[model samples]
Target: MAGTIQRHPVSPVSALRLFFVAGWRSNLALFRWMRPSAFIPTLIGVPALQLIFFVHLGRYLDTQPVSYYALGNALHACAMAGLFAPAMSLAGERFAGTLPALLATPANRTLMFAGRTVTAVLVGCSSTVVMLILGSVLTDFRLPAEGIVPISAAILVTAASCSAFGLLVGAAGLRTREAILLGNLVLYLMLLVCGINIPRESLPDGLRLIGEIMPMTHGIAAARQAFTGSGPVTGLLLVELGKGLSFLVLAVLTLRFLERGSRRAASLDEV
Candidate 1:
């Protein structure tokens, strides 16, 4: 046994702690929106302004009730936190010159990256709540007492789903510098196709199909139904959860694949 070392496996509780600690540190390091100057405008001011714009636009068009736009845009605002934050978190490691060090660690790649989603989901849910409150105060948006629980659940699920999708974009950032650009592209694409501003029924068949498979569509529908207390929300929530899981799987796989390729090619530090 001379000169040999034995390593004990980490306990479950310790593993959990490591997961959270790594995630928190990753968020602190990579997610710049945590700063007051960035946080205020990104999470609060931007979403609030977006809600106001859409609410007034809907009023001018006189197409749908104010609640419709309010709920839709509020749900969409969650993406600002859920999507952009996580994408930046992973992609930023490369830009910060930490990717090589990160890869050199003995941590579980999946858990480390997935843990980043925890803060993203929390921030996203906060953004959703803020948008909802602004909608209620500034517009005719109202959530029935019975609908509150379901709407809250929908918001949480939708935020998680958006965070998962963001991880996928971050995975791509391992290979290229366009992760943030891709995140913006997907965000606006969802805005148009995910029934945020316009009805999916009005979109062409191709765009409608795209929206169907995307993250926010079902969550937005579930929230709207919850807002009105018109129908059962279980199905929509389940579908939204499924979509999140799918994106999470894809992101993990993509991260692993890229990590291996970079190691083989000695390119982890290349950018």
Candidate 2:
């Protein structure tokens, strides 16, 4: 009794505040170890390097490689980051022994989970802006003045959609320890099938069919349209937003289901 640690019940208001704070701190912790040199290389440099590679490679084959790669890769970075961050958060919470408490809290699960995911969505959006700025600087390409509004809107939708999908992945992650691996797998799958480097039509028929259901497929097209000042196809943006909503609904249901099972098994603390 003397050595026992006292644990106080967290008030709903306090839990909500901590929920948002945890999201911010978790995202910050992700980059804390990486000094600018290392962090920049991964976050900004890799995409810039990829842009350069495509620019040079396109020189031999085409006159407008920047047009092809700049927007695509920028959007790719944003989509992937948004898509994985929440999932990684779930895995981290599990490993840290905080997930069960968070999930089991009397607080509204939807509000709590959404609060925790906001930073990741913002990270995704900021990454998109950074990649676009970097790509423009490193190449002849530039963001069109007229396209700015449309592009910004498209970026927001892409980030939102990917964040929802990531939340779904996080919910599923409650059942397994491999959430991070699942996140990476989804990221690469999107890269290949979402037309990041190649046209979606160029994909094999089977993969193309699969790509249609992927989170960022329509969002990427909207991104390209935004770059051209053609206006984001409203249908595409709607589809992306719809997909995100559907994923969020699915995540909520999955989390509820898993919670039921965990309660029966009395294994909420199990990682």
Candidate 3:
């Protein structure tokens, strides 16, 4: 009994505190490398410019209403934070030579990585709001007073879903240096297929199927419906929520699998 070590379960409060602290630190580390000048442009300016460009393009083509492009691109902008942030944060640990130390800790691995998504979702929502405001000011985009709550909820869900998918990209980064590249690839794929600029009906069946299973499709649809007060939004929102949960599960499983493999091979920090 003299050598016996008693293991105590982590209290709920302690777990909550750990989740909060991990999320806060993860967000800080995410932008620590950038100067304010670069950071501001990357976060706000790039997305704003993107929205402006596409809105004008849509106007030139004379295909859809300005609100269509505005809402679509604004939702798409969520990925700038939702996808890139988590991938960079997780993969950055390897780049910074800290993954080994992080893995050596006694904390819950899932909680630690998952907490990082909180800030990502917050930043994503902020990005969405900024895009919406810009759309309203620069174009004919308008949200009815009653439509605000549903649209806001749809944005939050979409960001969470995108962050979940980003975690999967981050998990892959555990072993490779191409995580950012992969994130960019997925982002563009979503842009092309997920009804951001072009309507889903315009896409080929194969691409439409791909978009159906992806994150932003349903959320974008739900938000659009909410804005117009046309169709039932609850169904779309539920499907979006389901997509997020699926990605979240896959990310956690992929992370755990990679973590085990890396630990077994003594390659946790090899990137």
Clashing pairs in 1: none
Model 2 TM-score (2 dp): 0.83
lDDT of residue 26 for candidate 2 = 67
Which of candidates 1 and 2 is the stronger one according to TM-score?
Answer: 1
**How far does residue 63 in candidate 2 sit from its true spot (Å)?**
9.0
Candidate 2 lDDT at 39 equals: 56
Backbone clash total for model 1 is 0
Candidate 3 residue-wise lDDT, 10-98, digit = tens: 88888887787987786787567346786678778988998999999999998998899999999988888889888998788888898
Which lDDT tens digits does candidate 2 get at residues 134-157? Answer: 777777788778778777887888
Off by over 4 Å in 1: 1-9, 32-34
Ranking by lDDT: 1, 3, 2
Can you list the residue pairs that collide in candidate 3?
none
lDDT, residue 78, model 2: 69
User: Global lDDT of each model?
Assistant: 0.89, 0.75, 0.88
Query: Order the candidates by TM-score, highest first — what do you get?
Result: 1, 3, 2
State residue 27's C-alpha deviation in candidate 3, in Å: 2.0
Compare the candidates by lDDT and give the number of the best one.
Answer: 1
TM-score on alpha carbons, each prediction? 0.95, 0.83, 0.94
